[model samples]
Target chain A: MTSTTVTSDVPALVFVDDLAEGFGAPARPFHGASPFHRADPASTPIDVLDLGITRGDGVFETAGVNHGHPQAIDAHLARMARSAALLDLPAPRIEVWRRAVQEAIEAWGSDGHGAAKLIYTRGIEGTGVPTGWVYVWAEEPEGPIERRDGITVVLLDRGYRSDVAKTSPWLLQGAKTLSYALNQATLREAQRRGADDAVYTSTDGFLLEGPHASLILRFGDEFITPGTDQGILKGTTQGDAFDWLEGQGYGVGARQVRVEEFAAADAAWLVSSVRCAVPITRVDDREMAIDRQVTDGLNAFLLERDC
Target chain B: MTSTTVTSDVPALVFVDDLAEGFGAPARPFHGASPFHRADPASTPIDVLDLGITRGDGVFETAGVNHGHPQAIDAHLARMARSAALLDLPAPRIEVWRRAVQEAIEAWGSDGHGAAKLIYTRGIEGTGVPTGWVYVWAEEPEGPIERRDGITVVLLDRGYRSDVAKTSPWLLQGAKTLSYALNQATLREAQRRGADDAVYTSTDGFLLEGPHASLILRFGDEFITPGTDQGILKGTTQGDAFDWLEGQGYGVGARQVRVEEFAAADAAWLVSSVRCAVPITRVDDREMAIDRQVTDGLNAFLLERDC
Candidate 1:
């Protein structure tokens, strides 16, 4: 492993030889974060800066790193395959991506924390290859625990392209794509309105997912999040936790969660690869009880799985 | 005016001293076309590239240039003003823009063509000044005819963000901005579906406008198009044509236009600054009768006004 010093406060970038030619490296430790690099490196790296990515014209996946190993790598890869097929981009080679992840983990050394991102772009202009950009970043567990307490979410009645392919077309559903300007804008607007995050509602008032994030699952003992049909990005960690809960005899299902029903839920939690599980203490300023069972179950699952 | 040798097939680009700068020696002959320059003079001398245009972060107006003069310039300017306000961008000085147009006309010399473009952008990174880029490209006249034709348009359910603004958002709409990838994609899709241009519908089925254009008087003589309330870019030419028609004792108003109604209109035309009242001859292989009065009225109105 080689270390290079970068003087600018911007993210450090590097070039990887294994990801084929022309792929730019991520700013050292912030894998898969938006605005990957503030400046374009001089090397003209191919894998990272392709138009497919610069235009948000591709799909991706981020898997939870457990003991420096990506968990459920197959599941994340399967989702990416589905997303790539939907977007009409070429699917990535699962084996090659897995190898790249392993190599990245080995380079990061043992004490590395956080998730590993498997970024598959449409590759170079004419090769028709599903170019991949993989990197591992340390995940900081600093999400507000009050988030698990409950969240005050406002319904924005505008700005979302498709409500059907929420998780598949993550380009809008916080799929970790480069085209996140609007999602960022939506969040800014929500912040301006004194809300934690904004849930996009259809023009006709159908409840959609949150911007650059997913909706909270809150309904009795039956935890429910908006289905893939609802246009919410299928969060990796969330999916894993739900599966684990279901194995433990809990009801987990994807359903058409309505705005009113979401507001009236007994407890709610926002899930993501990085945030893991955070409770929403309020819904549009309405307070709700934080069910200790849900949090405990999630924490135990994370611990057992060592994510 | 000093004539320069034109060599490149892509046309020469000329830079101006300022947004308000003029270009013709004896400027009387050339009046009412915005001045422009190439972004990289040494690379492409004769290629005129508008800096404000390349970003698609600007607003623009296309007006009919009749007998070397811009028609309906005030109405176009007014619409651009509204668009700029929507994006919180500064509006260009009307008089200065008008003079720049005149300078551009003189620089291009008489070409027996008519078409003026007014482009205003957020300007370069940091000059603490709103730099504007303007240019007018002449479209050779197709023989004057009294009868009008109808255009065949395809209905695309792609959602656009600034459907309410009269001018599209620079980022998504790509109207004033030179980012025309999506526009080109939509057009290609329309052509594939066997249509002349595309009319984008909202995800909820509300009819918006066309790609890089607007719809006008599709069904009956109602003179309807997607209103600002429908998230459609406010069409200046459509508005002006309707206002003029109403002044001439014709009933005209903007209303929600459906695909079925558009297909069944007595006479339908796509309106824009460059195309100006282009009659629709066929729509998705469906034929329709051309409305002569509508075309005659539009042409007369164009001849009477000075942009």
Candidate 2:
């Protein structure tokens, strides 16, 4: 069953063929073949033995799609490769995945804002093969409202020290993996604490990233995000935002952020792919002033990102 | 795509209908109907949006099967419920799952040792309904050999304190969730280090469990496993083994173990469902003597378990 015509906001799924046919692997037997093809969303292409679901043994990237272009496509793909390497999975064929993303976006008939979630997994157990898929769908309309109204966030303990990725690489920190049960639990915890979102603080009192977004704080005129050395994912959206902030004559950098520094910050926002840049109006019991001008500009820049 | 016949050692899949129909939920429209049914292993059934695959937002239990009987099923199911509660997933219907396991085992035509893995997920994204499946398959023929000959292990840092479960419940430390990329990575790391398996130690230097198994160290005549307070899963296999040990008039208990005490122990074993109890011949660079009599007796009892 195939449906090329984009209808409602339902997700369009595409499966990648030979997801990790890198250097040592032989070329596909069939020549002139596309690396990916759209599959029926209703069908379950995933096997019961697929480690992707069975073990959550996979890496994924959700890139914001503006019109027909995937935002930070290179960065997202690079991060995916890095995550795969961290998990010791095979290196993903970037060009093939890049083409797959574009094909998925085009097949979804992207006319406005959407998200393309690229998934690469260790595939079926004992197969020595990998699985890849790109699912594209229209973004929810509430993103704009969330950006405008702002969100409340709470600082929660991440239960790991800042140097965890360096000390324990098997812990799989800094990797956007399918093993996100803890991340989802963290989000639910934030909601349970009467907050819309949460910023993770390391066990030793260092500020980290959010469950699904990167934390960016503005102190005076300087913008800063937690350094990537602290076992946090390299934020693609925050990187792009920093570039825009620099262009606007604002000092932007990355460094180790203390948990207590949240009070001294002029403003804060959680930046990521689908949600873009969302201003944090409240941090725990503290209600901070929101920079409406900067927030608006950042959102505009993020939503319209072509690269 | 229906196959009721068990052809080879391939897996037999069964889907549970209304997986989480516990209290405060609607009953099945048809009464006196089976809560689960056999599924075609070759057919695609899982949706791409399943949180099980996307976020690894789910709980699972693997019970060893012998002569069509699921070993430690009750314990496995109970642990699954505990894992679900830890992740805030809906409470699973135990009776339905028990029946599903039986049906799956029957469908698989289990004649010897096998494994029945039960997976209950938070379901497709945005869908309140949960997803569940029972997969039964024949076990590899190497467990007896490994149990008799033994395996080597390396100690890896778990990157968390022993009391993490109580301090940060959102970490989902003790839960048997599908987010096992780290567990898989730990195994790979051990393999890379020229070891057969990996045992985890807390950041504060407390001996923990293995990536997929429980650690049991024999000191003199007393056997000790890591206390459950250390953010580790309560080992169902170890629990049963303890019962057998008690029958043999041996002291078995759980407590906080120090990593440095490994050298002082008489023997150690990494025990799990599928692998049963495999003696640890070496830890890191230290070679330990294997208890062949206890190992063989334990495997025999475990393989012949009726419950």
Please state the error at residue A83 of candidate 2 in Å. 0.7
- Tens-place lDDT digits, model 1, residues B234-306: 7767777777878877677776666677666787777776666767667666776778777877856755555
Off by over 4 Å in 1: A1-81, A90-150, A158-182, A201-207, A247-249, A296-307, B1-151, B156-193, B201-206, B218-223, B236-252, B258-260, B272-278, B289-307
CAPRI level of candidate 1: incorrect
Model 1 lDDT, residue B234, Cα: 70
**How far is A186's C-alpha from truth in model 1 (Å)?**
3.4
> Best-fitting candidate, measured by lDDT?
2
Q: Tens digit of lDDT per residue, candidate 2, span B27-127? A: 23332366666777777556778889999999999999988899999899999999999988888889889999998999988588899999999877775
Enumerate residue pairs that collide in model 2: A44-B44
Give lDDT tens digits, candidate 1, residues A57-159: 4455666665777776777777776666554455455555666776666555555446666555554334444344555656544444543455566667544
Summing lDDT over every window of 10 consecutive residues in candidate 2 chain A, give the lowest-scoring window: A1-10
- Candidate 2: regions farther than 4 A off: A1-10, A22-32, A141-144, B1-9, B22-32, B141-144
DockQ of 2: 0.49
Alpha carbon lDDT of residue B211, candidate 1?
68
